[model samples]
Target: MAHIVILGAGIGGMPMAYEMRALARAEDKITVISNNPKFHFVPSNPWVAVDWRKRDDIEIEIAPVLAKKKIDFIGVGAKRLHPEKNQVELDDGRTVDYDYLVIATGPKLAFDEIEGLGPKGHTQSICHVDHAVEAEKGWQDFVKNPGHVVVGAVQGASCYGPAYEYAMIMDTDLRKRKIRDKVPMTFVTAEPYIGHLGLGGVGDSKGLLESVMRDRHIKWICNAKTTKVEAGKMYVTEHNEDGTPKKEHVLDFKFSMMLPAFKGIDAVFGIEGLTNPRGFILIDPQQRNPKFKNIYAVGVCVAIPPVEATPVPTGAPKTGYMIESMVTATAHNIRDELDGKQPSTKATWNAVCLADFGDTGACFVALPQIPPRNVNWFSQGKWVHLAKIAFEKYFMRKMKAGTSEPLFEKMVMNALGIMKLKDK
Candidate 1:
């Protein structure tokens, strides 16, 4: 029996385990190795920071769900990956041998890159459930004595949606509390513009986001490189288009949340020919490492180059739907290989995301995720917020049921002509 091992059990890995279980032969053993037993829906972390969601609302005990599907689960996490021997060393002094390995360990939050940034420092974060919970307490403390607020992504950061979401969510919550006037908000970002979003602006995203921020009375500084952050203050250098320093600002803030750069987890870092210099797995179009054919990677663990050079460094985002496509392709490719056939499936890598703003939200669809796409659309409305809520509920249910893609989800994607894999 061919054993397929899936590493990590967060947004990308859990679905990958389910999809692999569905596609593999009945006798093929599928196992998932995760650092934690609970799976937290990462997109809802912004809500958790603002009290819209509790810890239990977004977390699922993944072991029970995987057990129902007849899949093995190990929560000891990965200590080291011996790709040369097709063996994984676990933290609990155990080893797993697999014919195929899917690495979806997600990104290691690089908070230490900036001094006084991240949950352990001056700013708070919504990148992880525990971090979001801590931010909730910080939020509580801040609202008691409202002052300046700072929110955005820093240099070398990739994921920008949550930064935008948290900023707007906090704005909405403060407005509801009638203390918005007491809080002056400033958005500091690494993107050259308000809505670059690392894909070079998806269809008027810049215009729409800038307009919304203006409506909310939120000021912004783009192409900003945060030099340092002390308690209650932030130092930033705003860069010009020519890469020159346009201005420097030292702003005081009562509360701050800045998304940091992401890198591959330490388990597989520094592996020659397997990962880029940043520790992200190097994958071809099929999501398989060129040097290690039996190894595949998806989600933030995969290396994607920036769309274009910017005054301040920024990388492209690998959103939820795009990661799902990668997972689907990886499973199918492994199944083909197990059947003594060459792997051929390739993911569409489409980008479809809903960025909630508490009261309203923005939705974008980039057909290929990169520039020069067939369909690039971004729009905002209250219905988008409602749709995000519905998605969270449906996705959680689907995970609990161990279903890769629910019938309704498939139907909706089909109706929209959104294909997860390229037609062969």
Candidate 2:
């Protein structure tokens, strides 16, 4: 019986374990390794940061949930990955052997790349639930004495949805508190345009997002490179389309949340033929490492080139729908190998995003995440906000139930009338 070990217990890893369990032979062992004992819904982190949702509301004890599926759970995080030896060294000085390893460990937040960034430094973050909880403290303090607010993503950052969500949510929250007029907000992004979103602006996304920001009276600066952040002050260099600096600005803020760039976890970084220069796992079409065939990867840890180059570097986002497709394909491919069949399944890599602006939200769909896609759609409405809330609840329920069903594939695609976009 083959032992398949999955690393990290976040969105990508949890679903991967469940899907693998459903596909693998009964005797095949499936183990999930995570540093954190509990699985927190990352999408809800923005809400948590604003006190709209609490930590306990989005967190699920991982051990208990995996136990119900008869999967082994290891809370000790990986200290190092020895792909050649087919073993993972744990922080507790133990090692686990695996016939096949799936590296779903999400990206390491590269806050240190910039001076005085991250929660410990100057700006707040909602990347993790803990960060969000800490950011909530800052949010509370800010509401009491509101002033200039800064929010956006930094250079080389991949995930842009949450940055947009948080900015709008904060706006909505401040309005509710009747303190919005006192808080002048500015959105600073690495993207070439307001709605680039690292996918070259999905179907009028540029216009739509810019319009929304205007309606909310939120100002934005694109092609912005955040050089340094100090307490209540940010240093920014705006770039021209030719990648030359156009202007410099020093802005002061009472509160701020900036998304940092992501890199592969230390465990897998700098491994030859395994990861890119930025430490993102290098995988072929099948989501399996070209050199380490037994190793597979999904989610933000995987390397995907930028949809288009801008003055300031930006990375493509691996949205939930794309990650779900990757997980499904990886599971099927591994099953194929066990049965002495060649791997054939490939992830569609579609992008479907819901950016909640608290009371109202926007949704974007790209059939193929890459440029010149088959379908590109974007829309905004209060219904999108309600849909996002329903999605959060449904996802949390799915995780608790230990089901292998693909949430986006089964529900989102059908609801969007784009089930045909998925590969059968």
Candidate 3:
């Protein structure tokens, strides 16, 4: 029996496990290794930062769900990925052997890259639920005596949705707490504009998001590189579009959370040809590693060439939909690999987002994240917000319930309707 080991339990990992199970016979072992025993809905994490959602509100135990599918679920962190040896070392001194391996560990926050930019003791993050809880506590502490707040994404950062979502959620929450005016906020980011979003501003996103940020009275420092973060303050340098450094200074913040640039998780830090120089695994359009055909990567863990290299560096935003597509493709290809047949399909990149603006939201759909492609973006009212809320709830329930179907396929297609509307 062929053994399939999937690393991680995030968006890409969970779905892959179920898909592989469906492909293999009962004796073919399919096991999932993850650090998090309880899966937290990542997209909704921004809501948790501002106390809009509670810790228990968004978490579900992943073990039982995988077990129900007859897949072996191991709740242990992967320490080392020995791709050459065809084994993975767990944190508990155990090893797993596999004929096929799918790496979907998501990403590792490179907080230490900027000196003192992370939760050393006082700051908080919504990247994970634990971080969100800490951020909630920080917000509560700030509510007692609201002061200057700095919310933003750091330099070399790729994922932009969380930063945008967190900024608005904080604003909304502060308004709810009746202290919106008390906290002067600054959104600092590596992007040159309000909505560059790493895909270089998805179809007029710059103007629309800028207007939104302006309407909210949220001040911003763009093309800013975070140098260091201390208690209640963060250091930054504003750069020209040429990426040449110009001005630098420290901004005092009462409460702050900055999204860090991502690199591949530590487990596969130095696997030859498996990863690029920047720690992201190198994969073909099919999301399979060239040197290791049995190995595949999906989600933030894989590397995609940058659309443009600016003076201020920007990486592509691999959102939920992109990751979902990649994992789905991986699932199908693995199925083909096991059957000794050629893969029928390869995943391509498509960008779609329903970015929430707290009270309202915007929908962005693009054929290619880079230039030379079709694009459509539209902004609407509270209906968008409600739609987003419904989506979050539905996806949360569906993820916990363990969907065997490829759901994002429908989402990607439905988003195409809005894309058509944006053109009109």
Q: In terms of TM-score, which candidate is strongest? A: 2
lDDT of 3 at 399: 75
| Per-residue lDDT of model 2, residues 1-424, tens digit only | 9999999999899999999999999999999999999999999999999999999999999999999999999999999999999999999999999999999999999999999999989999999999999999999998998899999999999989999999999999989998889999999999999999999999899999999999999999999999999999999999999999999999999999999999999999999999999899999999999999999999989989988878999999998989999999999999999999989999999999888999999888898998788888887888789888998899999999999999977645654753234323
lDDT of every predicted structure (CA atoms): 0.91, 0.93, 0.82
Two-way TM-score contest, 1 vs 2, winner: 2
Best by lDDT: 2
Residue 415 shift from truth in candidate 3, angstroms: 3.2
Candidate numbers sorted by lDDT from highest down:
2, 1, 3
Mark the regions of model 2 whose C-alpha exceeds 4 Å error after superposition: 418-424
Model 3, 1-424: lDDT tens per residue?
Answer: 8899999998788888877787677788999999989888787788887778887888889889888888888999999998888999999999999999999898898887888867764457778888888888877888899888888888888888788888887888778778898988899988888888888777678888888888888899999988877777788899987778889968998988888888888899878889987789998878889998789998888898777776677789887777778888888888788888876667767777776767887777767667777654545567567877888788777877777667666666766765567568
Better of 2 and 3 by TM-score: 2
Q: Which regions of candidate 3 fall more than 4 Å away from where they truly are?
A: 418-424
